[model samples]
Target chain A: DAGITQSPRHKVTETGTPVTLRCHQTENHRYMYWYRQDPGHGLRLIHYSYGVKDTDKGEVSDGYSVSRSKTEDFLLTLESATSSQTSVYFCAISSGVWQAKPNTFGSGTRLTVV
Target chain B: EDQVTQSPEALRLQEGESSSLNCSYTVSGLRGLFWYRQDPGKGPEFLFTLYSAGEEKEKERLKATITKKESFLHITAPKPEDSATYLCAVLASGSRLTFGEGTQLTVNP
Candidate 1:
């Protein structure tokens, strides 16, 4: 278990409403990632941060936005929620620059958009 | 696109039955391969990392072996507590890791 926490462990939001999920870490890892797990799609990377204020898009970056203004926090926002976004979101942090070491994940956040 | 595919989408084994889960990958240049176990409603827990072909690593009842194109996770005499979804991911040319759908293993007592 990593010293990572995701705020709003569970969230329920209606369609077309704005929602945000937060990931906080005390490990001070340089690399952080956000992933979404669906029923059959496995876990897909949504976005990642290499450093403070430096971020990049991942395989499934549509309909989502992330901000990492500081080293310890990363935020993911959905401008308008959709039913398709209903899934478990996981936040992970790696201590290495290129994932030389395994990444540790937080407990996760379960989000349901109706 | 770098791809990872795990076989036997679901598996059921009696306690103490040894088995192996397969993860086949195709990437431009493999930097690393990762193994993770994910319980229901929880995030994945890291297990092992295999860096190159013919590399092997082990811990407790689990063993991970890698080749050029595929990797195998061997579980020896597993217990009910070992039941979980086994996920395999690969780090390709860049740092992004691509994941497989995962193999769900259920060890019955």
Candidate 2:
């Protein structure tokens, strides 16, 4: 298991409300990513950070935003949650480049928007 | 577009039964292929990373092999504890990965 920790393992929020998930790591990895898992969709990358304050959008970045002020913490925020945003969110950290080493993932956060 | 597809969406096997899971993919340039194991209600655990065709890696009873367009995870004499969903992903010279839906494997004792 990695040293990554995700807060609020399970969450339920009403539609059109703000929601945020936090990911903290102790490994001091240079890369961190947020991904959403849905039935029949596998894992879709939502956003990623190469370093503190350096972020990039992934394939499914719509309606979601992420910020990393320090090397160990990354935050994913849904300004106004929707039913479609309900899914299992996973946070991952990697010490090296994607091709150089495997990413270590934290236990997922199950979110439901009604 | 890069994509990954895993076959046999679900599989059932008896304890000690050896089997394999397949992951087929297409990418403009393959940087690495990764295999992961996920138990219910948990995040995925990394298993192996293959860099190119003809590369192979092994851990305990699990072995991963890769070719140009696909990768295979072979389990030898699996046990009930081996039951989990197997996920495969590909990194195409970028930081992000494209994953497959995964194959859910059930090993009954």
Best by TM-score: 2
For candidate 1, list the clashing residue pairs, or say none: none
Candidate 2 scores an iRMS of 2.0
- lDDT of each prediction vs. the true structure? 0.91, 0.92
TM-score of each: 0.96, 0.96
lDDT of 1 by residue, A1-114 (tens): 568999889999999999999999999899999999987787888988889999988888999999999999999999999999999999999888744544788889999999
lDDT of 2 by residue, A53-80 (tens): 9999988999999999999999999999
* DockQ values per model: 0.64, 0.67
lDDT of 2 at A11: 98
Clashing pairs in 2: none
Candidate 2 overall lDDT versus native: 0.92
